[model samples]
Target chain A: MKLLELRGLAASVDEKQILNGIDLTVNAGEVHAIMGPNGSGKSTLSNILGGRDGYTVTEGEIELMGAPVNGMSVEERALTGLFLGFQHPIEIPGVTNMEFLKVAIDSHRISLGEEEMNTRDFMVQVRDISKRLELSTEFLKRFVNVGFSGGEKKRNEILQLMLLQPRLAFLDETDSGLDVDALQVVARGINEFRSDENGVVLVTHYQRLLNYVNVDFVHIMINGTIVKSGDAQLAHEVETHGYTGLGEA
Target chain B: MAVPQPANTLQGDLLKRVLAHEVQETPWLDRSASKSLLNCNGFPFPWKGRWQYSDFRALVEDALSLEGAHNALQSSHDVDVRRFDQPETEAQTMEFGSSDGVGDFPLIDINGVLFRSGTKLSSIAKTGSVKVNDANGSVDRHLMSIEQDAGMTVEETFKTGNRVVLCHVRDNAKLEYELTMPHGEGIGYHCLVVWLAKGSTFELHLASKGAQVRRNDVIVNVLGENATATLSGGWFVDGSDHLDSQVYMNHRVGGSHSEQSFHGVVDDRARSVFSGFIHIDRNASATEAHLTNRNIALSTQARAHAQPELEIYTDDVICSHGATTGHLDDDSLFLLRSRGIGEESARAMLTKGFLRQVVHSEGGTSLLNL
Candidate 1:
């Protein structure tokens, strides 16, 4: 089944056009890498898809699980199994990481008419996932993303992805600012969560992350629209020839 | 000195009633201080530098009207658990000076006069100290609990009946004081005066919920060198409740330190006023003092007034004060919502966490539950 489909998606910030005529689709079990240059509206597309405010969709249609999601609120979209991993995770002081995760998971469960996770079981699940992500149990006691290193913030995002287990995830430049070791750890987390029941849209500039997390399709975005779509080899071609080389294609 | 009548009729009537109460005999009473306090018209209003952001006229009137009624001075005794006094020694009978005219509020003066008039007082003494060394080479000192015999636990509700508390932490002693105010009707006032001797340490934890009018005035005098004091509290206000608190940390000698952290959450048409003043005397060289007041307004009609002031005369001292009032962070809200948390739940969690940060501990947990 098609997990997410965006047709002729055009959005603008403050009356300035950003994403122009963006059309993309992701089927279940597919991993699509979106490579773009600076100001190419890559982040804009991710934000609009997540239903963030301040971005006006001039002309577009966004569907999740074959249902229209253009009018849904951010939380509503999230409750429907759509997640957006921010490039720069915000630091929320005073809210413990564990408390935030519990609320997020419980909210989703309650919306789906499922019972809330008990403390013992919730802690067990969190411990298992945290260990896999190389996170200390002490990290759960601290405020969400507060005072965390750049690499820690990226790992925290992947941690949420694993716990929330959204059917469709948009990772916008999640590999930025991560060292090779941290990148490998984050990639392993992503690989562990990927399956036939869900899909991922990897929005990044480098092919390094693609190497770790297999990508079925590569789309080169320039000037707010996808200019080229090809197999995984296209990512290496862009890496070798640069974005300007693709502009002439 | 003859008592002066306040020009304001309502205030004058209230002062007369207060002065008419029989003066209780006590060896610690300072007649001169009481006489001088009676001569003042009334507590200062917002025009006064110290009371710039708080007004007590309405609260005073409401309290005075209940003075002689049946429900007047309803002694719930719940809040009385927080009252801790030291055995009176010759050293504790020092002259009671008038308000320093800068940091002291009129409510404190009223409390002083009433205290001299023999209000109910309690005493709790420390037998021995428990000191534990930390990994950082610092020592954790534990003093006697206020409720030593009753098991160290706080009561859920603080029925704010009019009362006066006199606390003394002697040399080389340490003490922790906790107080929680519950929701109630009518106006309530509580006054606490603490004296710290040389080498003494004092920590205070205060928490209050919504009420018609609840006011707490705390005065701490670091009388000797090497004395330290830490004050932290949280207040939650909803509906039309009004919560006003004032803290005065007086560093009278050199080498003294003091710190204060207070947080408040105002909802609906509720309002809160927090005024913290740290006064470093001219001779209090090498003294260090810091104060921070943080507040969040949950509704458009809710209001919060925070004034953190520092008065330092010694050039060798370090003192700083800061106050901030605003709604919850938008980025924080977005972050929570993006994680699938509902908007209302997200707001509630953030507000609770904000207050919890100020009063985070076993003692604080009880207060939050209230």
Candidate 2:
């Protein structure tokens, strides 16, 4: 079954149309990349899928596991296993990273009618994931993303992605500000979490991240809609020729 | 022109009620000093510059009625009074006006009168001081623990009426004092005075939860050289409750450091007032003092008033103060909500984080449970 299906998904920000009839689908075990020029509504697509506020769905339908998700709140979409990694992660001073992760995980668990993870097991799981992501234990003690470097913030997003283990993930420009080493770590985290039962969507402007994570399909989005769909070579073509060179693709 | 004394009757009524209590003459509670203070600085009114945002006339009147006064004072085991030296059952008569321009405050005057003639005093067993000497000679890194007066319970209910706490930390000693006030109704006037000796460190944490009306006045005097004092308070006012906190830090000698951090949350129609003053006297050069007060109003009707003031007399001292009042950060709320946490839970978490700074700074998380 398809993990996510967007049928004529149309959305706008502040009464301005951004996503004009965007149709996409991601099946289990598949990875999809959406490359777009600036203001192509890439982030808007991810935010609308994740049910962020202020993004009005003027017309369209969003489905998760073949079930419609209309009018679902941000947290409701998240509890249903949809995660949107922010392009610019917010800094919440005073909310420690550990506390945030615990709450998020518990919220998902409670929504699924499962017992909350005990502290011992939760700490063990976090330790394993932090070690894999090269995040220091001390980082978990600090405020969430407060004073973190650009690369650190992106890695923190991937860290949440790995822990939440959503069925479908929308990484909105997660590779924007990461260094080579941090990018490799983030890609490794994504690869480790990717499985036959889950789907991944990578939204980016460049093909650098594609070098680390292979994709089954690459969609070119221009002016609020996907203009072209191709295999991995399309991403390399855009990187080599730039978006301006691919006219009316 | 004569000052309009609209609260004269209220003051007269309060004085009458205070005099009705059994009188005990002690040097610390000098009736003459109290009367003089009252004469010079009458009851606090909104017209007063410092009290412009806070009016205590109504609270004082409610307290004077004596309705439910006994029930309010009954559940008082939660009030912990910790002292390093032998508990002084016989109150030591200390000069009130020793600090320049401090003893003239209206709250201090009322506290003086209430302490002298009204209310009985109790003493708990003494506890030894916790001392930490820095082998590395670093003034910034010091060891301290919240010390409980030996016989008092860890939790204490706030009793209405007047209460006074006097603490003196010996030279080179480090002490952490924590006071937790549980949920209750009625009015309370509490005064806490602390004296730090040379090279000593004093950390104070006060947390008040759901008090109908509470007024806390804390005065810390850094008398010795190289002494440091930190005062942190968190107040959660809800319903129709009101909380007013006044903190005064006096840097008497050079090389002393002091800081005050206060965080308050006002919900429903509740109101919170915070006034912090740091006075750096002359010859107190090299003194570093800072005060910050931040408050969050949760409801449309909730109100918070903060005044962080600094009076520096010396040129070679560093002193600054800041006060801010606003609702919760929308970005923070969205961040939490995006992580699968519901809106209400996310709000509660943010609010807890707001107050966690004060509690965690002084290692007083136990107060959160209360």
Candidate 3:
């Protein structure tokens, strides 16, 4: 099943074109890696797809599960199986991780016409996921990402990923600023989340994260458009040759 | 403990409750020393000092309309005064006057000017707790001194009108004061003045819910050495409500430490103002003071103003201050929304989190729900 399709997608911020004429498709059970240098607009694609403010889509079509996402709000898109793991997770003091997680899950339940998860069952599920992510149970009681180390913040994002469980997930720089250990944990989460029923759009600055997570396709983006598309080995070529003049039409 | 002074007496005719007119002697209006406050035809410049963000004239106008004397202060005082250790004479009798370090604020004069009744209590207790509840919009004046080596706790819950609390923590004494203003349709104001003597300690907890307009002025003066003071406040306002929380901590001697922290949330078209001031005298050398105010504005139309002022004359003192006023963090909002939470519910949860932080700052349970 096709999870996401972006055909000739173009977007801009402050009236300046950012994602210009981009095209991509992700089917269920496939993981696509998007790599680029600074200002290549890798994050812009994720932001536009995620329905963030300040970005105007100049031209394109975004569909999740064969439905147009043109007029959907951010939360609506999320409920429709669109999730973007932020590169810079926000620090919200006083909002405990447990509360945030429960509320997020309950929101989905309410939207899907399902019963809200009880506290005991929710705690059990969260504790299991947090344990898998090497997060202490006490972490659930603390404010979301407040005073958390860089590694901890990354892992917490993964924890959210596993719990929220979007059908098509866009991991935007999820591996940036993470140590070797934290990167492996994030890779583990991606591997655990990947299935024949879900898809992944991994955007990163380096090929370091691609080493751990297997990729079905690799696309090198530049000037707000993908200039190179190839198999998994293409990542090695870019790592070795650099992106100096890779955009050869 | 022999409680001698009747509850209705004040030094002389000064604290008496009387109407101000040509018919009778208005002994209560003492306009000699605090004339700057009493004789003000209108508030100073509306945009001056603490009144910068909030217009004093508007607050005064609306608060006056809500003023009424119904059910004069539903109060219940539980004074557990142990044996007065010192001879009754040694318990210093301090008179209420302008010389006692209270700044001449116009709001204080407005409170003293219009009030159906004025209740005065001069208590010297070792360990006592007093709880006063005021649903009626009435003004109250209370003077209490924690005798040397004594301790006292005061909890007040009120709505509308004004409340003036004059407290003195004598040498080696402690004072814990807490004030809660529930959500109300009227206005509310509280003016708290605390004086700490040598080796004394003082703590103030102020929690206010939404109101039409509210102002709290808690000033603590550390005159003695080896004293410690802590003040924490929380407030939440929504709709067209407005709140102004002002705090001032002064260190006169050395070897004293003081801290002031305030957290609040403003939603809808509400406006919240916070002003924290810390001053260290020239002789207050080893004095340490810190002030921090954190606020979250939930709506684009909502406004928050935070002013942190510090004046340190001594070289050995350590003073720090920080104030922030911003809308609900976008990053947090995005994270929540991207997880399938609706925009409204996510904002509400984030707002609740912010309020809970403010309430639990003083280690109190979170009784507020959004």
Candidate 4:
């Protein structure tokens, strides 16, 4: 069974079409890069897969691990190993990051009939992952995302990506608003999360992220659907020549 | 659940009955309250921002139900307590619900007030606990004073009652007072009025939850230069509960600082009303003050009203006020739910975070069953 698949997916928000008959398939161990111009429905597609509200799926079928993703709640999808890293992680004051991630991980384990993690072992694991992501363990004690810089927010999202270890990770513009150094850190975290048992669909705007995290397929999205699909060379071409003629072709 | 009390109209005679039946010759019970009490004129109709969303007529009548006063807060041996008339306090002058445009709340007469004798509070800093052991009463009044250059920490608790604590922090003194209002089905009206003299510091942390009717008021007057006051509170209400929290900060002197922040969570058919008013007197130059009140409604039927007001009459003053009344941020909730947390648990976590923004465990936990 494929990890994630979108068939004839069309979506709209506020009575306006955003995704017009888009089709994509993500198999295990495969990384797909979905690059799009502004208002090209790349975010709409990611949001639709993540079950975010305010988006009306006019016509589409989302399948995760061969099971129809329709009618599944947001948390249900997450428990089923579907994680979408938001571009902008919100600030939740008064909730420690450690507590938030622990609860999330505990929920995932309970759904899989696994016991809760040992607190001591969990802390060790958190420290190790945070160190690898170049984040201070002190951040785990602070409130989630409060007073966090743009780069810090992006790195925190990557931290979640490594902790949850879901089957399919759909990241939405996670590299935007990040410096070169912070971008490399984020890319490294994403690269570490890649494995033969999982799939990743990176929704991005620039090829800089692709330089660090190689993708098997690069799909250039214009209007509402993928206008062009090729190997990593497609992203480099779009960067040099732009989508001026690519969309028309 | 409908309030067990009938939808009785607030009669004019109610004020006269309170004064005639229970009148103490104290500054807190001064006749100044009579005008505001009668001005209510039978609680204005819905709209015009007067007693619209939540009504206190039930709590008023409930507080005045019994004849004579339930016992004043009995102080244990560790704490010193006295009557309002015991200390020579400045008489009369304190007014309520005037010139703030906050809401036309009725002013109930002060029944019985307890004042801690100021003779013991000395220049040295000390820690003291004031327990309202039997404070469950129709009305309870407490007056305290921290002497010049003195410092003390006070913690008070009450089950179900109306309490008014008027404190005087002399010049160069510091006081930290934490108030805990427990969960009860009865009614309560609690008010804490403080006067901070020159260079004095005052902090009041309060946690209130679950009552048929619970009213809280924190009024502070920065009367001296360099005086500072920080007031914070958290309230949780659900299942037909009603919480009314009002804050008033008067910066009358220059070089003073004050911040007022409160957060509350409303669920089910419960209701919460929060109004914060910061007044910077013309002479209050170089004063800095901020007021914030945040409320979150968990249910569609739940209601939250936040009104933060500022009246700055002086320049070179950093003064601002903000109030927001709405549901928890959808993005925050989605962030949690997208991480595999169940919807119900994620919402509860967000709701707790919303309230904990201002209220901390160091103060106390009084969220009914939170």
Q: Which is better, 2 or 4, measured by DockQ?
A: 4
For model 1, how does the per-residue alpha-carbon lDDT over A98-193 read when each residue is reduced to its tens digit? 999998999999999999999899999999999999999888999999889999999999999999999998999999999999999999999998
lDDT of 4 at A66: 88
Identify the runs in model 1 with alpha carbons over 4 angstroms from their true place: A245-249, B1-10, B23-32, B40-42, B45-55, B62-104, B112-157, B361-363
Q: After superposition, how far is residue A76 of candidate 4 from its true place, in Å?
A: 1.2
User: What is the DockQ score of candidate 2, to 2 decimals?
Assistant: 0.65
State candidate 4's DockQ.
0.73
DockQ each: 0.76, 0.65, 0.78, 0.73
Clashing pairs in 4: B113-B141, B114-B141
Tens-digit lDDT track for model 4 on A200-228? Answer: 99999889899999999999999998888
Q: Order the candidates by lDDT, highest first — what do you get?
A: 3, 4, 1, 2
The 10-residue segment of model 3 chain A with minimum total lDDT is A240-249
Off by over 4 Å in 4: B1-12, B22-60, B66-108, B112-124, B361-363, B366-370
lDDT of 4 by residue, B73-168 (tens): 444333454443343444412322112222233443332212111112223444544545435555555556777887767667765666666677
Best by lDDT: 3
Which candidate model has the greater DockQ, 1 or 3? 3
For candidate 4, the per-residue lDDT at A98 reads: 92
Candidate 1 structure quality by residue, lDDT tens digits, B118-233: 21222244432221111111101111223222212222234444444455566766666666676767666666677788887878787788668777778898988888888888
Error of 4 at B353 (Å): 0.9
Structure candidate 2, residue pairs in collision: B78-B155, B78-B156, B78-B157, B79-B156, B82-B149
How does chain A of every candidate compare to the true chain A by TM-score?
0.98, 0.98, 0.98, 0.98
Candidate 2 per-residue lDDT over residues B218-299, each given as its tens digit: 8888888988998887888899987888898999899999988888889999988898988888979999999999999999
lDDT of 4: 0.76
